[model samples]
Target chain A: MTAKTTKFVQGNEACVEGALYAGLDFFAGYPITPSTEIMELLARRLPANGGKFIQMEDEIASMCAVIGASLTGRKVLTATSGPGFSLKQEALGFAVMAEIPCVIVNVQRGGPSTGNPTHVAQGDVNQARWGTHGDHAIVALTASNHQDVFAMTVEAFNIAETYRTPVILLLDEVVGHMRERLTVPEAGAIPLVERLRTSVRKGVDYHPYLPRDDGRLPMSDFGGVHRYNVTGLFHDMWGFPSDNPGVVHGLIRHLMDKIENNAHRLAHYKTYHLQDAETVLISYGSAARSALHVTENLRARGERIGLMELQTLWPFPAEQVARECGHAKQVVVVEMNTGHMCQMVRAALGPPARVFLANRMDGVLITPTDIKAHLRLIAGRGV
Target chain B: MSVQDYIRERFFPHIWCPGCGHGTVLNNLVRAVETLGLDKNEIVMVSGIGCSSRIAGYLDFHTLHTLHGRALAFATGVKLSRPELNVIVPMGDGDALAIGGNHFIHAARRNINITAIVMNNRIYGMTGGQFSPLSGEATTATTAPFGTIDPDFDTVALATAAGASYVARTTTYHVQEIRKRIAEAIVHPGFAVVEVMSQCPTYFGRKNKQGDAVEMLRRYKEGTVPLDKQPADPEKIPRGVFVQRERPEYCKRYEHLVQAAMTDGAALT
Candidate 1:
């Protein structure tokens, strides 16, 4: 049977399709607002695809289960919203420390503690980077529309598998609930990245955390002939817990360098009409939709305004932001949160650009009208 | 191969106290695996954080030392991913009953084919003799120097009520019984819990005024009553299997459901 190439799908539903296409065979999650549909869809479809889906008792267990399933050489996923994401922080850290490959989708709602359950919010932008304690790096992606949601979900999985780290797909209620037409790629068209398993014989020369030339150690399945130890503690090259300062320093450096040194390759963004633009708007997730609309309207009116929509958030795409915003006289960061990503934008641009923010956090999205008004104000002030 | 063959020699001279009952429990666990003739590679040992949880690191098998109180959840992942592997979790009282109580009950409810060996030492030995959920009422602990008013849990009863297909209780002092029950649990087709009442001499013993590990073992022997015997004192904890019955295992049922779904082609939904 041939697969449908085009279909009207909600952002959350597209996430499920993306996961399946990316080779996700195991899903463990609990029901949470906005994100529940992703889990529900997977629960219905995973079994049909001969995969496994389980509704764990809570988000913590869900995260732990995802990590465990990943250890068995299966691509695993879990979805949750704000409060549930809070509960998953520790387990997420565990995945980082152990270098397990998995994907986590956070359909973000307003929260400081279940502040608003059914509304859109970008409050988790910082949490996605610093939610888990300790010194670590993470890859987070935001989806602006249904098609991007589907495509980014696959990219999230690939990034996770390539880095052996948990990649967070941060979606807000706007895109999560909105339905749009998406062109599903045919099978074999979407590139899939699988975890690199060691070629060494099982018991001959297997070291769990020993790094190859490229700085990543190949993974081994739990039930495979390559029996090795997996732990949450800082460990030596053999995956055994160690307290030696030198070993620990090297471990931390390697973990950081893997993502930092390759940030250029991992960074992803789209620039619309950025050439010779005098003003640029920086946005991500659902808020980027408004920025795009405003940029198009303003450009038609002969305004030198462009938009730089960020698909990858964490590791911040600093160099790309700096290069894209270099020629612009002013930059405005638009978001549903008060000023989360705006800080990073300002940090990337630094002094002299007069960085401004157009934000809303009252469970309402930042509209194109708001961005237009902000631009008008800047134009009138002539500052 | 002998039990000693299962020991990860690189981690020898374990960090457990000289007379701590954890050694005895580990010995029984290794013997149980040996008796079943299960290949070491086919067995995955998991543990949460605690004195008992450390056992996973010293065993010669695919092992995961997970977050505190999260071993059962991790083990569930392993068992579901590869149903053929024998997944075993060794957790402390706090690790099993306190922080991980939700996972414990839910795992039993699902009746997943993972053996949870809860080493109930009554006190949080790793955290320096603090009160645990399994510590009896009025028991003096570091956290409760004046005496604890909290009630204790009957682990066997709790496991049985939580829908565990197999439940048994034994003390570390009963080496042969521990080995027998552990072997039985490993072979059980569904969720099985064997709660081993281990002794913590360093903290539990000194804090409670019980003599060292030897005296604690003697006291445990005196306190436990065989399941078939009825003691006049209703407070005495019962020993032996409290529940063992047949039910479809979680992973097996999941596999069957997958097969049905594949054959019916979305009609099952």
Candidate 2:
């Protein structure tokens, strides 16, 4: 028989399938809107796959559970949207400081506090970057469609395991609730990467936080032979908390370097019609979908406009944006949130270029026509 | 064996303040863990931020010093991930029931197979004895120095009502009883909670003139009425196993359901 044809699945359901296929063995989450189906699907499916699914009391517990489960050598994950994501901030910070690998799915909705729970909004773009207190590094992926939700969720787990930090799969209500035909390849067809489990023995006195020659530590599972402490406080190579300034400084620097040094591996962005264009449109998450619609329509009208859609939102893809927009006369940034991604685009494009922002924070997604109007306005401005 | 042998000497004298009930709670926990014959490697102790949470640092088990009021959450994760391993949480009044109150209630509600030892001294011990959710009515704490006007929580009753399959309460003075309860809580098939009525001799003690550590234990001994001596009235029933029933544990039920589903799929074949 021929391989089964593609089936239409909700983005959230596809996310669950992708996570299960990626070897996600544990899911600890509290139910919230838009993202609730992700948890609901996992709750039904994880057990059949010889995994555990826990509906925690709240988002804070959901986060802590994932971290604790991850420490025990399980590929753990959690899903939340808007306010639930807010409650997970401290635990996310703890995961970063302790270098525990976990995946957090933040299904975006109109936010600040329980705003537009049933509606779509990409307002969490900035929160995904700076929601957690203190200076920290993060990797966030935005899925524009259901198919990408499946692909990105798997990638989120892999990136989390590889980097030994929490990876945010930022999906908005649009993509999360939307149904699309999904074509998932055989599990082994795509590579599934687990963390680097160092072969360190117990009583050898290992440091869990010790950086490698490249300033990145290959994490060993907690129950494995390696013995080390894991704490939220700053510490040296050993997981024990320390007050030593040298250890504190080195700890922060190493955490930053581990991701920064490998920015090329972590950064992902897609370009459309950039080969010949006078105006470039920068967008991410749900806004990217609308931007694509506008770009295609404008292309049909014989307008030379390009679309730069960001998949990885952090480590900012600075060089790629600067390089691509080098020859373009003007870059127009369209985002659903109040101009958060646009600010980053402006920063990356710098002073020599004129970057215009078309932002909407009224708890509604920027529609294709809305984006088209902004493109027309930007073009109206002589560049 | 010497106290030094029971505890990693380097980790002690513990950070617990002089005469604090947390030390007593910690002593019982260590004893309980030891009695279970759990290999230190096969056991993991996780704690949230607070004085009681500091117990992880003193124990020899593989430990996770986690975020505040999140010990139960973390422990749930740890236990679910490695069902073969034993996981315990040592959290304080505020850590267990205030910032983490929702987790506490839900963990009980889910009846996850794990042991939660809450050191209920009725105040936030680490944050300088602030009035916690479990503090007695009209009691003075740092946050309620003028005398607390807020109603205190009955954690044992709350947990029992929330569906903890095993629930018990004992005070610091009842060390042996507490140890037995801790061991029982550990072996229980569902979410088991042993709420130890500890004495915060440092802040809660000095503030309320509750007496020194020794005297505080004395008061605890004098104050608690044994369960056998309690009246029949539900409202005034003395603390003990406020509720105990054997329900299918969270993991076991999940395992059974999954197996049934898999078998059903097989039969379809």
Candidate 3:
């Protein structure tokens, strides 16, 4: 007898497989609809691999625990949907300030406040960027389908470890709960990034907050021989809270520069049939899958409409989008939420590019036909 | 305790105000670590934003001073990630019970294998003298100019109800009793909360007209009734090791279950 080679898995379950393959050793989460399967799978699987799983009382605790585990040298992860994501904002800020590496999967549902628990919405697109209170750079990935969910989750882990920051895997409820066949590669088959470790030499003082001239720093874990202090307040290389103006300026500049310097490597997007096109469709997350399908369908009908799919939703992939949108006569943005990512597209397009937004906030996905209909409307107008 | 110890020597310039009760609480905590005989490398201290939270940065062990009101959350992560390490958190009243109140309740409820010592000084001494959740009703502070009409929380009772395996309370004046309870809480093997009824003489004492530090100590000694030895009056219930019991520690149970699964896999083959 042999094990089944391929089994149908929910997008949420594929997320767990990705985390495990990415070397995630701890899962601290609070259960919410649409994202509950990620928690459930980890609850069973993590303990089997000498990893830890904790169903925290709420999303705030969940985020804190994940950051905590990351500081102690474990690859940690957590999952939540709408209300839970709202609860996690403060701790998310802590992760940003302290530069802890962890992965947060927000299987998004409708709401400013738990509007529809079991329904799908991409209302969190802007939230994922500015949900936490601070001026900081965020690394977020949007998954279009189950396969992308698995692959992007692994990418999220690698990016977080490489940069030493929290990476959000943004998924809508439609993709998260929907079942599909997934083929996960063997653990060693894919690329995995581990955080840079330090060498211990007694008598040499180690500054955990030491900023590289390039603005990046390696993490020093707890129990290492290095005498290091880690704090949330603005600190010098020694990690003690400092009120000095120069130190404060240097600290904020360095923190921002670390991610900004490597923005080219961290940013990613996908383009579909943009060659010799007058009209283009720009979308992301679950809606991007529809955009891709609709772009293909429109191409078959001799319509020259291209598609620009955002893989890295944050830091916006502004340069690539500017190049694509700059050429097109008209660009239409399609998404589940109203005018969130569209605002970014408009900003990137500037003036002279007629921008049309097709949005829905009714806890339902925007279909390919709906987007195509909007494109046809834009195509018909002359004045 | 030796002044030459790695932990103590590094964490000097302790920030407690002169004759403040937090010093005694810190002293007892250090002694408890000494009594446990755990290696300095194996101990991890986590704290939040406050005067008490500053202890982590000074300590010689692996330490993290996380965001305000989120120490237990971070401590939970540290302890769970490295189950072999002994974790401790010492926080002030507002840092532990008010801003961090949700974490406090849930940490107790999960009964994670960590010891949290809350220095309950009844006021937010670090940020001027605002009334804390643990400050008693009718107590006067900077924020509560006339009187605090809000009811104070009985943190020990809250921990007990929240499922802490070991819960205890002692005033800073009772140094020996506090030291003993700290040791007991450390050894209990589950989520243990030792609420040290501390004094903030500069802020809380002056505002309430509780005299100087010495007078505040006297008031604590007179007001609290001991758990073992009872006062005749019902109102004078003493504060000394109020709750203690054995329960399943969270991380240990998780460790056992995983080991069992490994064994079962071996047997199946």
Candidate 4:
């Protein structure tokens, strides 16, 4: 392994550093709470690193700019919170439909609409998956700490480039503000993924959306000789708008299959003490930290409990959740929202596992004490 | 290459209705690009949702047909990411002024090197006949059957005040003038606005007693005054170059900053 240097950094700061290491050179964002630091840091560092940063007028424009930059063969990034993320949904859909590669960091705060600006919440879990309209696929990852934030930012870019789709790096206010020691990996140590550009001669034989044998289309830069169209409308392989049912159906299915077929490769999680546990705690993001602490304490007291911390939230990772929590007598889903992922866990675990929710949505972290209380209740039921 | 070579013929017969002035505007735009001898591969035509925005599909350039009023934001990204390409945006009156008003002003304020062509037809033609920000007061539209109380926007004035380096206005009736203005806007080296007063005979003309396409074209010829022949009445639409001044373009300034940062050894962190 290459030598690395450890430095004290906030989660948000580590996100920017990680993006730079991932070869990000274009950033377009509008400042919002719990996520503004990512944009501010990028503004200062991007120019120095031979990258570009633009503060757009609003979240919509910021998202649009990110998509535009990505089309020109640059790794682009943007960060926002609850309300800003909502404003970015339309353009986010644009990126999804156009198959642009970019990363969006949503340092989530409490919200139905501006519920709490400086507090932690994973309320955007569902929004990140289904925020945009229509039938489309997405990849989202949640980071629980400063180091995880750095590592996941790099992974977010790689996943986006590999799939040619937008990846949401979901963080909560607590992880964003909390500072910790994070190791800066040596240059070229962390694996990087670059977009596949068209190798077909420019004017000779090129169609923008023509898929390769692997089912992913190679993108061309806007100014490159291989000029072609990009549109939000349902398009044929030539990238021009088409209302033909066969073309429309093929386009949508290809987009979905590209991610769904590769779900096994993208699904990621961490398990603790699952070897002989009878109860499993299913949690993610900041809430996972609490669950892990609770699991360790309960195990010390000789309770057969384990923790399954999910890092990749979307493509739901149902198979992994089922395999890990299938045999448990009880499965408790700990989250900062009112049963967003809990519903998915239930669907994944099915009837026999007896899924239960341990949630807190009042802009406060779900503490170990609360999770322990839930575990005690489950144990008392004596399944 | 011939003008026919620049057209995406497979996507045509064009969508514009008979007598629609947007066809003329499109024709002028094509001629303008042709006059400058720009390679089709090096140009990007971006458009928002409107009848005019459909031109992006019919052009063989690198085009983006984006959301209603968000074309400028998307084009800004394309231009900044690859400054070597010439980016042009075509927007309707409602698309540019009603929904995309903020982006319009900000893009001009930045003075980025992109040419914006506003097809000011004075009404929302694509969505039927709704009153737009540029619809003349007292004009009857579907949403304003009793005559509109809302004031119309002077697109040229707004763009000029917003810091665009080049601003000009011409009617679709003045085909040669529109083509000349579009070419000038493209070569301006900074943010440029060319407001083409296009006629929506299907909506605005039918609603206002402006007769058919021919009558509306005749009215355009008779109603508008040249900038030198200014009438005392402020309502008269004057046609000419309203603003042209030199300033460093946004992308150039960004490049200079990048160069300085690289040479000074100033780390971003």
| Model 3 DockQ class | medium
**Cα displacement (Å) at residue B162, model 4:** 1.1
lDDT of 4 by residue, B226-252 (tens): 887766645667988988999889999
lDDT: which candidate is best?
Answer: 1
Clashing pairs in 4: none
The candidates, ranked best first by DockQ, are: 4, 1, 3, 2
Instruction: Provide the lDDT at B131 for model 2.
Output: 91
lDDT of 3 by residue, B90-143 (tens): 888888888899999988988998889999889988888899988889999888
Model 3 clash pairs are B225-B237, B225-B238, B226-B238
Which runs of model 1 end up more than 4 angstroms from their true locations? Answer: A1-4, A381-383, B231-235, B266-269
TM-score winner: 1
Q: How far is candidate 4 from the true structure (C-alpha RMSD, Å)?
A: 1.8
Docking quality (DockQ) for each candidate: 0.73, 0.53, 0.56, 0.77
Clashes of 2: 0
Tens-digit lDDT track of model 3 for A1-383: 02224558889988888888889999999889989988888777777677888988778888989988898899999999988888888888778878889899999999988699888899998889999886887888988877778889999999899878889999989989889998887657678999976563755777777866655577778765665667888887777778899998887777677777677787777788998777888888888888889889989989888998888888677778888878888898888988888898888878877889987789878888778678667768522
Models 1 onward score TM values of 0.98, 0.93, 0.94, 0.97
lDDT of 2 by residue, A1-383 (tens): 02433668888988887887789989988889989998887776777667788887778888999998898889988999999999899999999899998999999999789899988888888888999998888889887877778888888988888888889999988888888888877757668888887767657766677777866567766566654567898866767667889988888887788887777888788899998888898888777888998888888999888998888887678888888887888898887877887788788878888898887777677888787677667768532
Give every prediction's interface RMSD: 1.6, 2.6, 3.0, 1.4
Candidate 4 residue spans exceeding 4 A from truth: A1-3, A381-383, B231-235, B263-267
Ranked by TM-score from best down, the candidates are 1, 4, 3, 2
| Model 3 lDDT, residue A187, Cα | 54
What is the per-residue lDDT of model 2 for residues B30-59, given as tens digits with 9 covering 90 to 100?
A: 787678766667777888888888788777
